[model samples]
Target: MIGKVPKPGKSFGGCIEYNVLKKDAAVLYADGVRIDKVAHTIDDFNMQRKMNPSLGQAVGHIALSWSPNDKGKLDDEKMVEIAKEYLQKMKIQDTQVLMVRHKDKEHPHLHIVYNRVNNQGKTITDKFQHYNNLKFSKQLTLKYGMYMAKGKEQVNRPQLKGIDKLKYELHDTIKAAIKKVNNITELKKELAKQGIDTYFKFRSGTSEIQGISFGKGKYKFKGSEIDRSLSYSKITQAIQQNVQQRESEQVQHKQFVSDLKAAVQSQTSAFPQRQSTGGKSLLEVLLTPEYIEPMPYIYDTDERKKKRKKAKSDL
Candidate 1:
């Protein structure tokens, strides 16, 4: 494994955001911070900096990544253990910290964001930190031999043959199909086009499913044998998650369109109103109420008043 620490920052908000908010990101461990929401997490880190208010750069960020060869060997628990040790050797202990794993790349990697201000309100010195990182990263790698193995997918593929070739082909095909499909039924349909068939093993004398297998040409293999992530349970969970995510994106899109329309209507006059209004479809004109002209009034003349006026008209 290797460790890279970036320059410290004055604010925790952006640093925390970059680590925790990304595709396939997971929070493996945290200390002295809330994990429920990004806003709360940032607030927790900032609240800690109140101890050493004089420290301009309070955010410490590190990215720990392992070779793709070690991806299978390094689970979250193992990664967290290494991270805590790395922090200790670097003398970055007793600080508010968060560790998050990201699967966006082929190699397994994680991020660590911590406060430079310790619990005792003293600033943690970062002097000679890069040198320390170089030494400790090598030391830790030697201590964990399994992580130093060759990468799993480093072999040449074009020359492969037999069941091994088929297995790798299926692994790649299934992975690609999973992204486009939302469920196993749909995946089966997609794979069928590629001359692959899916079969489910059921419990004896019962409709309950126990396992799954895939077939192509003459050979068949269990889902787990091809790849652990290709197993029935994990695939089903992934499909369900895809469904939920699609629904969420659709809702967000609808809300965005709604908000955009509302904003357009609210501030339509902000732009050139001359053509917007029927007269000047502008905002000011559209917002003003239409004007109405009042009707003229007339009075009726009485006969008795007219006769009195005629008698006095002798003058």
Candidate 2:
């Protein structure tokens, strides 16, 4: 097992985040902590109360992940023991440590949570401390001789049988088609030509995200499911970027319309009018209140009034 420990630093919004990354080579057992429970406790004591739930700071979070080769051979009890070892190595003595095994994915991992400041009032300083955790984890791996992930070969050759190769190639072909096409119509045609049929669906109260599944020569992809850059930062960043670009274009179009209207209003003139007799307003005679009751009258010149009077008589 290998580990990478990074120093605690300010997060995107200026709040400090203390995190630890551990490669879980030992597949004993796995568990998880309820983040709300942990966050509530941490927030109640470590921060001033606030109405915003996400406003609280993250005291500390530790993630232990490992690639799994055997799904059924995990030791649950040993997994908790290993978690305790990590806490001991981190020198967290008096804090409540929660350990959980997450089985959502193929691999098993342990997520641990502990207070940075111990009950004894001792603060754990960030002193290249992650190195210690990694060192201990490596030592444990060596002691147990757990299944370690092999490093990438220099020649970049994959080890797969003939049937496996065909399955993998088909998977890649479908994946490539999905990436190239924009809308569903084009994607379906492309997949059909490649002897693959796809289905799309959506779920509510979940991620509001989309996903794809391939099985038995059938391909299914949700237009919104696959993330373009999963290897990058949080998924929210990508979503936010797409939304901002759309909003920016909308704002530019609105501004263009506004400028065009302003230009026309500033440069254009109204229709020319004839003078009125008796020094009355030309609009008043043209639109007399008596003729269009309850509306303001438009008095016009004698010539213009004569034309309107003639038109009313014809009507």
Candidate 3:
């Protein structure tokens, strides 16, 4: 499951209109709102917003999306249930919320329209709403055995827009670059060639890189934020592993060449009459060892020890 918390809006009129009046939109659930008509719902949200007239952004909107793989398992009722649990986990309580499911895309998704001015007229803070949305949505995804997407490959690139599109572009570019380069410096150079910039967050007063971010055009996102596997340490570890693997392969190749030369020398020199197994070359037989299962081990039992002890007593 994926969740997006759009920037808060000043009014619910446009937000409610889009979610409610869309062609494929269906209002699955409503709380603390008049469900009789669209205007009534808008008025209900406005009346609640009046409680906290000082707050500018009283419209809180969130979009929850699931992969196409989960289309079968999710129904309107089940989605509303999960959405409520998600809202509860996100601390969006004491607020008026309207959940509407839309069948516009291949995936099952819903839009949650909520009042920032909650039931008691208190402002619902959105300080960590983005982080919380990500954290809680994932928690619910696993908690309910929802279809877990393996990676970004399952994402529909064409359907992505705005900040999401930029983030995924960075993810794909960085991943492709990492495969060709073996270190951070080379990674930065490669990304630079592609018009991408890499920024490192240093540990306080130290040269150590604690975090990393990538930028393209006007947008930037933390490497870890792009995906956990793209973190600073993760990327560094990947470079080191690639370097070690290449070196190991080179050493193995050199050893194999040396062994083949030695075999050829033996065939021409002292051991010219090389032995063969089923007409195979000496080197071929040496390179491919036949598998032989070893005999099972047997341990001397305590009963055998006792019998030996009894025989010793006879002596």
Could you give me the TM-score of model 3 versus the true structure? 0.75
Q: lDDT: which is higher, 1 or 3? A: 3
Q: For this target, which candidate reaches the highest TM-score against the unseen true structure?
A: 3
- The most accurate candidate by lDDT is 3
Clashes of each: 5, 20, 0
Name the better of 2 and 3 by lDDT: 3
All-Cα superposition RMSD per candidate: 25.4, 25.1, 13.1
The collision pairs in model 3 are none
| Tens-place lDDT digits, model 3, residues 1-315 | 999887899879999999999997899999999978999999999999999899999999999999888888899989999999999988899899999999998889999999999999999899877667778888999998888878888888887777777788889989988878978999999999999999999999999889999988876778888888899999999888888998999999889978897877676555545344577665555566682335786657987898899999999
Q: Candidate 1's C-alpha lDDT? A: 0.82
Q: List the residue pairs that clash in candidate 1.
A: 269-283, 273-282, 276-281, 277-280, 277-281
After the best TM-score superposition of candidate 1, give how far the Cα of residue 31 lies from its true spot, in angstroms.
Answer: 0.6
Model 1 earns a TM-score of: 0.47
Candidate 3 overall lDDT versus native: 0.88
How high is the CA lDDT of each candidate model?
0.82, 0.48, 0.88
